[model samples]
Target: MRPFLFLGVRPEDAPADDEYDAMLRCTGLDESTLRRVRLEAAPLGVVDLDAWSGIVVGGGPFCVSDPEDDKSAVQRRVEADLSRLLDAVVPADKPFFGACYGIGTLGRHQGGVVDRAHPEPVGAVTVELTAAGRADPVLGVAPPRFGAFVGHKESLSVLPAHAVLLASSPTAPVQAFRVGRHVYATQFHPELDADGLATRVEAYRFDGYFDPTEAADVVAAARTSGVRTVPPVLRAFVERHLHPRTDSGSGRGVLRDEIGAAQG
Candidate 1:
């Protein structure tokens, strides 16, 4: 079985590691089966999509809606690297799951309007599944309505024409969507539990998701909200894509051959 790749853009080591651990817990994958790539530390060089069962991108402090001039050099590099990688992931319809910042990266790559028009504060929000979401193989694992943690400065204001709306909240209309058969993105953090959200509230206290003075209140609310169903969606994705048949003519097998040949 191939390992699943997790791309993280958090520059801070403490929060980045914590996020990875949280993902491991949520997805039921250990370090051996789940690999981590800190994109802030280095460029995302040639990635073989076939080498992993699937890909999971973690959220970070970077906002895609920020002006190009205001973006740090690292942010620009990370965006460029992701664009290059998505060039392969999207067209091939590879299995992918993105949370929070992941929505920005994937949405922007798919020509969606990612802006600050629907920013949600650092707390739990009730996410309701759409008709399509209720039928989706991965998202269907979640209830039609459940709470999920969210704290972001930007969202998919306009979903791409090719994307199917999945779960939504009252505030964020495009809370979750599927691009193809396997690609998915969510504006909420499915990997976050009460303790995980509280850890991030402290780590990013001054990052402007909310007023620094309100961090404690945000943490308290997160602890009380009881977000449990969202994590199962992530687990379902891992279970579904963890083993791809490598026989000839299969999608994963063809992708493996193409990527392997390109790399060689």
Candidate 2:
């Protein structure tokens, strides 16, 4: 069986470990089941995309909305790497899913505008699935109005031509989108639950999103905030798509440690 790849770029030692775990826990799949997650450790080289069944990207602190002058060295390098990845993935119309930071990458790759005009604070916001979204087998289990943890300083101001807006919130117009047949991008951190989002609020408090003094308040809101089901979508994606496409004979216990190791 081919393993699904998870790409992340928060510098291995970011202060938001708890938040990362919390967010991923919402994916519902056990770490063992998601056995092929990895980070772009060194160069912005072209990654081998054919080896995996799919790709999942996590959130980061870097801002895609920032101008060229303000973009960090690591951010630029990561963008270049992502560009290469997208060139390969999108052209083939491969299966892909991205959250938060991932949305900006897909939008930029597809020639959409990404900016800070619709930044949402580090709190829970309601997300309503579009008619297409409700009919989608992937999102069928999700409620019509569900809460999500949003702390993005940037979002897709306008969608690319080929993209379909799948979900939205009052604060951000493009909460989620699907490009072509297999690619998907979500503005909110679907990986995060209430507890997981609290870690991010605390870690990212002084950095922005909200007043540094109000970290306590943000934590309170995150704890009580309602959350939606994304893990089921994740499991469905892997089990429904990735599992069936594998070349390997075994499906169940493949690359368990690799999944846990790749996230760090």
- TM-score for each prediction? 0.90, 0.84
lDDT tens per residue, model 2, 157-246: 999987888889999999988877678888987777666666666566677788888888888877666443332455545554644543
* Candidate 1 global TM-score: 0.90
- Name the Cα RMSD for model 2: 6.9
Which candidate leads the pack in lDDT? 1
Off by over 4 Å in 1: 243-264
Candidate 1 clashing pairs? none
Top model number, TM-score? 1
Per-residue C-alpha lDDT of model 1 across residues 1-264, encoded as one tens digit per residue: 999999999998888988999899888899999999999999999999989889999999998889999999999999999889899999999999989999999999999999989989888898998988877777766666777889988999999999999989999999999998899999999888778787888889998889999888888877767664353677777877875332222122222232222112
Q: How many residue pairs clash in each candidate?
A: 0, 4
